[model samples]
Target chain A: MVERTVRIGSTHGLHARPAKLFTQAAAASGAAVTIQKAGGAPVNAASILAVIAQGIDHGDDVTIVVDGGDESAVLDQLVELLSTDHDE
Target chain B: MMEIKGTGIGQGVAVGPVVRMAEALPEPVDRPSHLDPEREGERARASLSVVAAELANRGAKAGGAAKDVLEAQAMMAEDPSLIDEVTKLLATGKTAERAVYESFAAYRDLLAGMGGYMGERAADLDDISQRVIAHLLKLPAPGVPNPGHPFVLVARDLAPADTATLDLDQVLGLVTVDGGPTSHTAILAREKSIVAIVGATDAASLADGDTVVVACR
Candidate 1:
């Protein structure tokens, strides 16, 4: 699995809209992906429900893991998604 | 009507009828499930999925910026961690309604305890919990009131879902008894250029049809 820790860029954090966008992207990637807040348990990144339950906020460090299926490319796309300010 | 002080949103002012959003459903009573744990679990799962799907549908209909907010809410309805929590509660013989309520409350308390931006999320959790419980009980989801006329909306606060579907043409202004400048109610008001005052604790006593001035300076 490939993993990267990135800071959340959405000013309002990873609440509803950003969480939905991130989860939809993860699910579409067709990769086994998981996300974890700092020192928190890892959750299915593609499950919007799991992502929002984490209550991740702006500037929070989250680790994204992609286990297979073109890991580098998928991770890069997810990283870009996480680091963009979707709330703007 | 008596004047109430709060942080105003935008620079506009409006006056009209007062229509209050329904108060949140009362907390679910803590009681053992009359049905077996498995049945209770099934019931809980069904309601969760139903609420989630409804939210997703609303998102699709809303489109644009509101679509994202509604979609996020739909996710909260079916979140994996939340399901785990509800299942655990069900295993303890709790009814599906109580299980969903308590499970969401656990997360709501967690966010509220965090304070600042996270604290504001407690309202979101409350909104979700209400949706799930309302589904389980076969009740209409509690939200914005349609009094069949343009009115000044009064509520404790406006959830994202409520604000997304609000009839801007019918709403002359908004007044909340509890909410800050950053609350969802405030954001929607500013975004739509509607007059609003939030965090006016005194507004709690305002009733339906009350006439009040929303002085935005």
Candidate 2:
């Protein structure tokens, strides 16, 4: 498994629209991925409900774990997604 | 006629009879399932998919901002964490209705407990739960009313699902008893330029078929 940490970049944090965009990308990635907020339990990154429930905000650091597929490539792509401000 | 007050959205005046959103469904009973867990799980998944598809369909038709909101709601219907909860409940011999109800309720309370923005999201979860339960029971999906004519819409609060597909031609104004200025109801009203009064606690007394003028400056 490969893990990467990135700070959330959306101005309003990972609320509805941004969360939806991120989860859609994650679910489409075809990798076994989970996201964890700093000091919080990990949850399926593709599950919009779990991700929203985490209430991850802008500047909050989150770790993404990828256990399958092209680990490095998928990790890098997800990290890119998480780092961009979707609200913009 | 009595005048009630709330934070208004947009500047408009409308007079019409009231058409209240359907009341929330009763909590599903916790009776043991008569079927095997596998069958119950199949039934639950089917209803979840149906509701998800319906929400997405509404999103597609509404377009614009409502598209994203409703699409996210569609994702919520099949969320893996919630499905896991339902699986556990079914393993305990709970009926699919009760299992789905309790599973979503658990998550709903969790989100609501977080308060603030998260608290507001609890309603979205409740809306999903109600849709799935209604599907399981083969009952009409609970949401905005289609009274077959022009009227004012009054409700405790408008869920995004309800607000997204509102018939602009039929709904003259909106009155919500429990939402704030930042609620989805208000936001959509502003976007759509609908006359609205939110947090009008007194509006609850306004029964169906009651005619009233909603004037917002």
Candidate 3:
């Protein structure tokens, strides 16, 4: 299991569009991905409900875990996405 | 001539022509040969500031936690990158309306594409609604009066973003192009005793402004 930690650069946190965007990238990678806040139980990366329920606020540190083939590429793209400011 | 029903989020009864405040549709313009990049950039900044100010005012006035979402949208609207994009479009000789439209279109498409992405993984209505609302926020404001007109508001559905900005003084009734009794607009209208109907595709074709009486009952 490869784990990557990234900070959400979006101003509104993971409540709306940014959450949707992150979930999309996770789905596209087609890996068994789980995202969780620090000290929180990870949930399915593909489920919007599970994600929003996580209540991730802006600037929170989240650890994304990808367990599948080519996890490196998926992690790289996701890392890039999370680190970039998507306040738009 | 049917009086369909819906939930009224706000209170009030309106009877006017059906003035459609759909997406702002602007015609594309030819590119200018002599460009003033600096001036155009300032203009973009100025226009976006106006939109941002309105968004901020609305966000502050929003009545619930959803207000946070509106505030976020205001921030996005004021983003430097968007201003840059608008400025570039105008410098390319596009009209103000054209630049604004194209910039908003790009955000809309991005949000919609993201919605498509989430829709594939989650089929729940709430999930879909959130994504759709996010996309709507990315677009320029779709200012629909809450009471709309005394006429019925005809739409695909009353998106949360659309519902958020609705003025309670203009709507009399509603006829949606799509949606059902369980939809947000229906539930709210019903609660407020506002008449609303859904699932009528012809609602979009109605040309009446605030003067025509729409009986969706």
Using TM-score as the measure, which candidate wins?
A: 2
Candidate 1: list runs displaced more than 4 Å.
A1-18, A36-41, A47-63, A67-76, A83-88, B61-64
Better of 1 and 2 by TM-score: 2
i-RMSD per candidate, Å: 2.8, 1.0, 10.1
Q: Which numbered prediction scores highest in DockQ against the true structure? A: 2
Docking class of 2: medium
Q: Which portions of model 2 miss their true places by more than 4 Å?
A: none
CA lDDT scores, all candidates in order: 0.85, 0.92, 0.59
Tens digit of lDDT per residue, candidate 3, span B1-217? 5343443333444566675646433334445525366665555566566655765576577556335545545555554344566777877776554565566555545444455333322222222223223333354344464442244566666644455555556666666776666665565566446666666665666664535444442
Point out the higher-scoring one by lDDT: 2 or 3: 2
Output DockQ, candidate 3.
Answer: 0.07
Which candidate wins on lDDT?
A: 2
**Candidate 3 structure quality by residue, lDDT tens digits, A1-88:** 7998999888867766676577767867879888989889988776544575566777899999999968999988887877777777
- DockQ for every prediction shown: 0.49, 0.77, 0.07
lDDT tens digits by residue: candidate 2, B106-148: 8889889988878877888899999999999999999888989
Name the 10 consecutive residues with the lowest summed lDDT in model 1 chain B: B114-123
Clashing pairs in 1: A13-A58, A49-B79
TM-score of chain A of each: 0.97, 0.95, 0.92
Error of 2 at B67 (Å): 2.0
